[model samples]
Target: MARTLAEKVWDQHLVRKGEGQEPDLLYIDLHLVHEVTSPQAFDGLRLAGRPVRRPDLTLATEDHNVPTLDVLAPIADPVSRTQVETLRKNCAEFGVRLYPMNHAEQGIVHVVGPQLGLTQPGTTVVCGDSHTSTHGAFGAMAFGIGTSEVEHVLATQTLPLKRFKTMAINVTSKDGRLRPGVTSKDVVLAIIAQIGTGGGQGYVLEYRGNVIENLSMEARMTICNMSIEAGARAGMIAPDETTFAYLKGRDHAPQGAQWDEAVEAWRELRTDDEAVFDAEVDVDGDALTPFVTWGTNPGQGLPLGENVPDPEAIVDENERVAAENALAYMGLEAGQPLRSVKVDTVFVGSCTNGRIEDLRATAEVLNGRKVADGVRMLVVPGSMRVRFQAEEEGLDKVFTDAGAEWRSAGCSMCLGMNPDQLAPGERSASTSNRNFEGRQGKGGRTHLVSPLVAAATAVRGTLSSPEDLV
Candidate 1:
């Protein structure tokens, strides 16, 4: 029978098929843990007198609670310190491998997995993070699970889940290629805008078509990382030569004969040509430009060239209300040019756009430029290895020379769980995924943007794109 990519991966991981309404039991290929979500799960295991069934398949890291500026310093916040310490103790007791703070492998769990090549095609991955969808770029069936599910996976190495409906999001360009300034970030923001936040409810999105195919693995990750923002269970891309090449010599990737066999099997993980999806959506890549969110939710975005929309102009009552509230919270007025909105800070790091490629791109924009006066810019790497790589490539110099602070890896300001945070009422142009209320800090206002836009914003002190700089 023909099957879509999501269905193929789901079937391959099923250990016990559901009868009637019972959920199917699926074997997990990888289980990712972090300081923020693992403590309670570990306690549940202890209370149940259970040992982790497959520690080898599990990986833990200290990211959410680790400080980025002075990583070696003792954690200042007691709550954060407790979480990191508890994670260390639990991993030691459970015989699970953990990458603690200051360890070279330590990073956002999502970034660490792909960087080490532990994320692979046709695998089932679960993390206690919404952005676990980032691994889906490798063609894995990855999604975030709740605390109870995390404990279940730890105890049994399996999770019970109903099958997800599949959706194909075909991205094409009018001229056969994207415009020079359009990036995966812009493409995804545009998608969210078109579909709204609830459009992908109950479905796994498979990104297909020429524009998606031409994107690099890092760019693909940036796209898949934000699937949850559009209310999708997950997002994925088909594994091809680009996927194989990225995994070729990484730490956990198969080697030699195993590599050949692995690639052969992975190549077959694609959706059959005649397979059907439950729904289909098409996005025009040519029409996309740099995109930025003006509201708390990701769906409230427009092209950088557009102006703030008037709530009265919206025909839908609910939409009009949302727009009105968003404008009030954002301190924006209807019909105001987006480019004129000034910011107090510019942040260029997050699991969504904190990879080496992202850093390089941000540096390219800031090479001979300086951040605008009164605008503080932070250039944080996603992981320590990414930080090392950036330093090796002199990207760090470019960032520092542009008056941006270069810092070690961790989630940093992405979630504002650690020392990095925005002051009350502070406005920022950030490359992070979500811009929800207090997502960066208490009462902080966020405008989600791409790395290119982030760097340019740092230079111009507004919600401006790289094109605006020229």
Candidate 2:
């Protein structure tokens, strides 16, 4: 039977199908966890006198609650400290591998997994973190689950899930070229804007078309990382030569002729040219620009040089109220030019855009420039592996020299589980996902932009595009 990559992976992991009553049971290949969500699950396991079914398949890390600054000390916030401490004790008690803070291997869950080659193609991966879809860049079926579901996976190494419809996003280039300055972030923002936030509901979006195939692994990750925000269970790109090459000889990737066999299987994990989809969306690569989220949700966004929408212009009163409130809280005047907005801080690191390529791009802009006065900019690598690679190429020095604070790899300010946070009423240009009120901290206003915009904003002290800086 013909199958999309998502279907192929899904079928391979099926353990059993209920008698026309519920969903199929899926054997999970990898289970990722973080400190913030695992404590309750661990306690549940203890209460039930259950042991983790496959400790080898499960791994945990302390990203959310770990302090980015002063990592050597016990965390100052008691609640944060407890979260981190509980994770440490649970991992030890459960025999699951853990990468604690300040450990060279520690960082964001999504960042650390791929860096360690733990994310392989044609597998089912689950995490307590929403960005688990980031692993779908490797052609895996990955998604986030809630705490109870996290416990279910830890106890059984499998999950019962209803089937999802399939969506194919075909992105083609008119002249066989990616429009200049049109990045992966722009591509996804355009996808969400076109489909609306709920477009991918009950579906797994598989990216197709020449543009998707041509994107680098890092770029592919940037696209899939936001699948959740688009209301997709997960998002994936087919595994091909690029996928195999990226995984070859990585620390956890398959090796020897096993590697060769893995490649063959991954190569087959693509949509049969004739396979059907529940729906399809097409995007012209030439039409995209550096995107920025204008309101709270990822769906409320616009291109650079655009003006904020006036609430009165919004047709839906509900939407109008939301827009007005988002603008008011962000301290952005409605209908004002987005480019004219100033940023108090700029952060360039997260599972979304904190890879070596992201760092290199930010460093490119910062190479010969300095951060604008009073702009507290930070450059955090998504993983220890990224940190080493960046430092090897002197990208770290470039950022620090440009006045951005360089920190060890971790989730950092992406979700502010750590010491990296925004003060009340502080506005920041961030490369991470989610811009909800208090996402970074109380009264923290977030503008979701690309790494290019983040670096440029840091340099200019305002929301900007790289072209404007040039």
Scored by CA lDDT, what does every candidate get? 0.93, 0.88
Say which candidate scores most in lDDT.
Answer: 1
Instruction: In angstroms, give how far residue 303 of model 1 lies from its true place.
Output: 0.2
Q: What residue runs in model 1 are displaced by over 4 Å at the alpha carbon?
A: 174-176
**What TM-score, over all chains together, does every model reach?**
0.99, 0.98
Clashes of each: 0, 0
Which lDDT tens digits does candidate 2 get at residues 5-122? 8888888998997569788999999999998888999999999999999999998887777666677888899999888888999999999999998788888899888878999999
| Deviating ranges (above 4 Å) for candidate 2 | none
- How far in Å is the alpha carbon of 297 misplaced in model 1? 0.2
Model 1 residue pairs with clashes: none
